[model samples]
Target: MSDLPPLDPPEGDGPDEAPDMAAAELALGLLDGDERAVAIRRVLAEPGFARSVDRWRTHLAQLFDLWPAVEAPDLFARIERSLDRPVEAPVATLALAPPTKSRLWPALAGLSSIAAAGLLVVLVARPVPVPPAPSARPTAPVVATRAPTLVAAIDPETAGVATVTAVYDAQAGAIRLTEAKLVGDDHSAELWVIPADGTPHSLGLLRARGGTALTLSRDNRARIAAGAVLAVTVEPIKGSPTGLPTGPVVAKGTLSPV
Candidate 1:
C-alpha cells in the first residue's frame, strides 16, 4: 500500500555512486516492514549483488522470523523513537601519515602478495569435492509418467453459449483454464471440476474471457487423478450456485491423465 517508486538510478550520479544508492534503498525497504524486507532479501540474492550482499543478508536474517508476531504500527513507533535518541560521538585519533609516491609500488606488491597468500590458504584449508560423473550415479525407478490432463475448456459459441477449458498438470499440481468468449452480457462464468464418482468441487470462477492458471489442493489433485468431469456454468458476478451449479452448462469436458 506504500506508494514507493520503483528503484532506479538517479540521473547524473557517477557509476560507483549508483550501487551505494541502490544498497541504501534496499536497506530502507527492509525498514518498511516484513513484506518489503522479504522482497529486499530476494532482490539482493540476484547475481549483481552476490559478493558484497552478505552484510544486508546477515542484518535481515536477524529479523526474518520476528516480524509476523509483532503488530506493525506499534513496532514502527518503537523504531521511530529509537532513531530519535542521540548518540555519543567517539573521540578522534591523529591521522596517519599519507604514503609517498615512491611507496605506492611496494604497497601494491604487498597487497598482491597478501591476496595470493589468502587464495593459497583458502585452497589448502578447503579443497573442492569432486562430484561423481552422471554415468557413475545409480538410476532410480521410473514411475508412470502421465501426460497433462485437459480438465476444462470453453468455446465462444455453441447454441448461443460460451465454452471454458480446464487442464490438470499433475507435475505442477495445478488446474489451468482457457476461456474462449463471453456467453451472457451480464452473467459471468464459473468453472467446476466434478469428480466422476463423487461430489463436485469448485475450481473458482472465471472472467468471461479471461484465462487463469491455478493450483489445486492435494485432495482435489487426487480427485482429478481419479478422473473428474470438468464443467463450466453461468454465474452472477460474485460466483455460482451456493452449493451447486444452478446455471446452465456453458461447456464440459472429461479429463484423462496422459
Candidate 2:
C-alpha cells in the first residue's frame, strides 16, 4: 500500500452525490487522517456503507490475485554511486591511423625465404620413426572394480501399510531411505539394522514423507553387509523411548548387495 493522502469526501451524502465513491476510497486505503476515522465510524454504524466497503475490498483483492508477484531488482548501490558523484562527459577519444603504401611485399618475401631455409635444415636433421618388431606381444586390457552397495525393499508388516526402500553405500558410509507412505503425524518412523548377532542397532529416525540420507558411525558401518536385516518401526516423534525399538515394527526386509 502506498503512503498517500486521504481522498476528500463529498460535502454531504445527498441524492446528487455518490457516497459509494467514498467507500471505494476507504477500501483502497486512500482514506487517512480525520477522513479515515469518520469512514471507520460509518463502517461500524451503517450496515449499507459497511457492505459497500466489503464489496470494494473484495473486488480490489481479486484484481491483485490476477497478477503474479514480481521480484524487484537491487539498484541501491547504483543509486548511491549516482548520488555520490555527478556524471561527466568524456574528455578525449581514440582514433585509428590512416593506411599508407609501404615496402611490405619485399619484407614478406625475405621472411619467407628465411623460413624455407630453416624448414629445409630441420627436415634434413630430423630422425625417422621406425616400425616395431613383429615378434612383440600385445598388452593386456585393464579391469575396473566398484565398491558394493546394499539394497533392501522393506515390506509392510500389515498389507496396505507404509513401506521403505533402503540403499547402503559402503564406500560413503551412508544409507539412503525412500519411504512409500506417510506415518501418523503424532508418531515418527525409525530405521534399524539387525546383523547376524540378532541384536537390532538404531540407524536413525526416518523422514515422514520423502527420501532421506543417514550417515552411519564407524561401528554401525561395519555391521552393514549382505544378509543383514533392515526394519522400520513407528515410534515417538523424537525417537524410541528406549535405545531399542519400543513400538511395533511396520516394515522389514533383508539387505542384499546391489
Candidate 3:
C-alpha cells in the first residue's frame, strides 16, 4: 500500500515554513483575524501566493466533486429515535500515529495532489466548536418602514407668477420643489416653511430650473409638519437680505401628509 501524505504540515513547521502551506491554510478557512487578513493581502499583492490559493481552491473543489455519495436510508428514523434519548455532552479524543513512512514521495505529482486534496477536505470538514471572537458583535436587523411624506401645491395668487409643487421627505429632511416656469434671473426664489406658530423659517434659495432639492436644517425640518404652509417669494439675487421675506409672496400652499 502507498503511504499517504500528511493533511497538515509537519508539527515542527513554523512561520518560516514554505508560503504554500500558508496559502492552503487560507483557502481552507483555517486562519482568522490578523493572520487571515495578512494572508488575503498576500494573495492580492503576491502573484505566487495568489496562484497557490487558486490552485488549492480548485483542488478542494475537485476533491469535493470526487467524493462518493452515500445514501442515508434510515436517517429520518434514526433522528426520530434520537429525539427520545437523553442529551449528553459530546466527547472527543485526539491521537497521533508515529510516522511509518520515511518519505511519502509519490512517483507521480498527480498522486501527491490527490492525497493532499483528500486530507485537506477531511481537515476542513471536521466539526469543531468555535467561540465567537471578542470583537465580533451581534448586530440588530434594521427594519425599514416607509417614512411619512407631505406634499403641497403652491398656486399663484396673481397672474405672471409660477405655480409650485413641494414634496417633503421627513426621513431625509429634504424638500423637492417642482415649478411650472423658471424664476427670473434678476429675482431669486426663496422658500419658507410656516408652522402653526405662524413663524416663517427660510429653507433656501430655489434655482432657475424646473425643480430643485433643498436639504433642511433640524430646526427647519421640525417646522415642516402637517397643516404647515410652504411659501415661495421673489427676493434679491442671493436671497432675502434680512431673514424674513422682503418681496411679494408669489405662491403659497399648505402641506398635508400623503
Residue 5 displacement (Å), model 3: 78
Superposed model 1: Cα runs more than 4 Å off: 1-157, 160-163
User: Residue 233 lDDT in model 1?
Assistant: 77
Please identify model 3 stretches exceeding 4 Å from their true place. Answer: 1-144, 160-162, 180-182
RMSD each, Å: 27.4, 31.6, 26.1
Write one digit per residue (lDDT tens) for candidate 2, span 1-258.
Answer: 789887776678565765447789999999789989999999999999999999999889978646754554555545444433423212111212222212222122222212222233223323332211233354333222256777776777776453455778787899886544535889988889999999999999887766678999999999998889988888899888898998888878778774
> Roughly what TM-score does model 2 have, to 2 decimal places?
0.43
Candidate 3 accuracy as TM-score: 0.43
| Candidate 3 lDDT over residue span 1-258, tens digit each | 469976787776786764547889998999999989999999999999999999999888867766655543545435434533434213212323322211211121122112232233223333442211333344443434357877776666665444456778788899876533435788898988889999888999887865688999998988998889988888999999999999988778778775
Better of 1 and 3 by TM-score: 3
Question: In candidate 1, what are the lDDT values of residues 1-258, reduced to their tens digit?
Answer: 589987785786766554444443465454467745654676667655543355665776778556554322335434434433433112111323333422332232222212232223223323222211224343443343445544333333354433334556688788665433545668766767777575677777776555577787777777775346766777786677586777877666656532
lDDT of each: 0.53, 0.68, 0.68
Assess candidate 3 and give its lDDT: 0.68
Q: Provide TM-scores for the models.
A: 0.38, 0.43, 0.43
Which is the winner by lDDT between candidate 1 and candidate 3?
A: 3
For candidate 1, the TM-score is 0.38
